[model samples]
Target: MSPLNMFSRLKNRKSSATASQHGSLPPIDKPMPSQCVSSPPVLPAATMHVKQSLQPAAVMQPKPATAAAPKPGSTDTVRSVVVHAKKLGSGAYGAVHLGTCYSTDGSVHCVAVKVISAERMRLESLSREASILKRLSRAGHPSAVRFYGWFSPGSKKVSTDATGPELTNLEVSHCLVMDRLSGGELFEYVLARKGLSEREAAPFLRQIAEGLAHAHSLGVAHRDLKLENVLISASPSGDDICKVCDFGLAYRYEVDGSGKVLKGRPLTETCGSKSYAAPEVLEGRGYDGFDADVWSCGICLFAMLAGFFPLDEATGADWRFERVKLATQHRQSATRTIFSFYDRPCQLSSQVVDMIDGMILVQPNRRLKTEDVLQSMWVIDDTIKADYADEYMYDEAPRYRGQAGSFDPNAVSGYGGQQDMAPLYRGAPAGVIAAPPPLMKQLAVLGQ
Candidate 1:
């Protein structure tokens, strides 16, 4: 069976735990060959319990356009752009449509237009996500999605969906323009490739770390860090890299509490998909958002490398989840812990499992940071080796100072260097988290 089928069985037919439910878009014309991400090398997974080589890629075929046909009579214009009936996806934030943009320079550009109706959705949440995207775009973080800009579309009518009138002629309160990614969500990409090898997944993993780290450094925690939110983009060099998208639940954060810096202000609202949510968040006990993000990243990694979910839902009721918890708690250390795994005995390398253990721990305090993940052998290689000690995320423009000095680097880098710095809280001044206890001798601290 393909990974798609395998994954469904793994989920036991439960809808994927998404913070937002995204509707499938009407398929657009496939882009030129240059835009396609070259398929990864298919490595043998005969040693593993499940099939790694999923043959015959699964493509999302657009249904026949059943909605009212686009007519010349319909004034489906938002600003200068023409909104087509083709929808990419829709959620609480707004409805997104494929559009033709007429630029001031006379250049015709294809773009994704997000239409937000004040009556239909909360303007506050939409504004928050938009602002965060704008900031990340201005920073030009390669892994975060590019934002063109947003504007209030005064009384402009836009189509919500092709199928229904209730959604049609939506008076747009505001609209957002963004790059129309030729490649779709990473969820669809994985389904096409079946599953990625450790080799194929490492580059993507590092890119995700880059995006996540940059967001954390900027004081944004992507509460929803699932496969669905990541999109594949073809590089100028023609290689495919994953981009993190969807900041609908992003936490701007609070960083004043001493313990808050390492984790985050205890998040009152439990967010994120059930399968990917951190145990602390699920329990709603003032959990940190940053730590919760790390847990979700582990779930993303497990799907790519193992080609299946490690568990259905990350709660005690599920036997798979219980087993993973048992392994983490009972095992003497990250290295020694072994998972019986869900539905099969796991055959992944010990190092990858250890990395997962570090991130997926039930306790938020001990969950590994993004830096800790970058340090994993399965994730790091020569390509990303420079990132091992680099604090590029926190560095301001034209300045490179991640090296050693009298000061601790994490504090100096503004939370970019360490796994746990306060969020809503910027990173501490160098080595603050790593520093020894104040007023205690080193020997005394070691029980001397």
Candidate 2:
């Protein structure tokens, strides 16, 4: 099936499910399918016993639940996790909820549990995600989410009316537990601000770049890297630390004989959210997963700075592809066109524009790698000067700053002026010019 159709079906399936019992399902304690069992094993539960090994010593640790050691070879036990009924969020594969895990000795640790029913199990992908999370946790990448562990209940036969072949098996549920991010989704945080200035967004962008660099270094590609998946962790001092989450679509392309990561193979799947997909991915051809990730990061950066998608779907059929094509035809003119969409002309620094250009380059081969992005002048300057230190390190209720009492989403201006530019491009190759559509449509579609 086409990517769009498949995505739509998956989305609809999740949306139609009853929300009252968000994660209420039969336990999947029984053995999973052969495919799942055969996947890479997660780091043993014993590894988690050493808290210092999992995170930096300076970082506060989750309070332990108990003082007792678990039985050898028993059901992997370190803590007992409870999933609260309050829904944190839901997606194509499952829903997440506020949860708490208690150590055997009686300490509580806050967490988010992503519950997936057996029916929706993309067993292979889910298994891969679990393995990747384990690797990330082991590496101690501060920006990546902490993977506590996952659970699948065993299979058990159930009787329907106490008479049949006594052969009905209850569908099992899978749960992935991770750190609960109280700061919420990045996109909503940005929208609430009307938009963030370049300085204001730099620190967050740096954190994301660091995370991506770590993942790529391990030859893992986050196929779906968008605003929503980037969670925020607010320190008591009000600093926001980014934590990239949701590895469900992550792919490990390279690994050594012992299964260590190394550069591996190219990916062909046309997966990921439509808006942030790179031009090559949208074209439905096999593409470099790493480069595609960079492109998505570029799109994300643009949204953080502009408060909207740079090339929205409503611009026209194949808008992103067309824009890229147009850009290739007239680089300077296209740059100007893009620049004009900003709220204030000349607001974006040259270094920032250069970095974005490198990332969003139409040719994947020419696109900036995550490491290159981290080393870019714009990022370097921001890191050194730290002009936005206050915003980055101590702004209590940061997400609510511009969104509180007096905020007005509709009153936001300097956007939507391009909505009337029908036939977004013209045949004139010299330098065709036409404004793109407003970003409101893109946001609306995403909300749906």
Best by lDDT: 2
Per-residue lDDT tens digits for candidate 1, residues 1-448, read 2111212222332322111111222222432222111111111111111111121235321121122322211223333666667788775545677876655566676778777676755655556777777767778878877776565555333323346553464454566677787788887766455456566677888888889988887767888788878888788999888889877677664334352433323555556665567777666556667788998898788766544455445665444454445444444322222222111223444445556666777777767788767665556543322221122212321111222222243442442233322211111232222211111000000000
Model 1 clashes, total count: 10
Model 2 Cα lDDT, one tens digit per residue, 1-448: 2111212222342232111101111222443233221211111111101001223345443231122322211324335666666678876556787777665676677888777766766565456667777778779878878767766644221101223321122225667777898999887787767567777788788989999988877777887788887898887789987877877766676555675654433455555665677867655555777888898898888778655566643123543445444544444322334544222232454455556666777778877788777766567655322243334323311121222123322322223322212222222222222332222211101111
Q: Which run of 10 residues does model 2 get worst, by summed lDDT?
A: 43-52
Candidates' TM-scores?
0.62, 0.66
TM-score attained by model 2: 0.66
Q: When superposed on Cα atoms, how far off is each prediction in RMSD?
A: 22.9, 18.7
lDDT of 1 at 420: 27
lDDT of 2 at 194: 54
The TM-score obtained by model 1 is 0.62
- As a whole number from 0 to 100, the lDDT of residue 398 in candidate 1 is 12
Task: Assess the local accuracy of residue 237 in candidate 1 as a C-alpha lDDT between 0 and 100.
Answer: 94
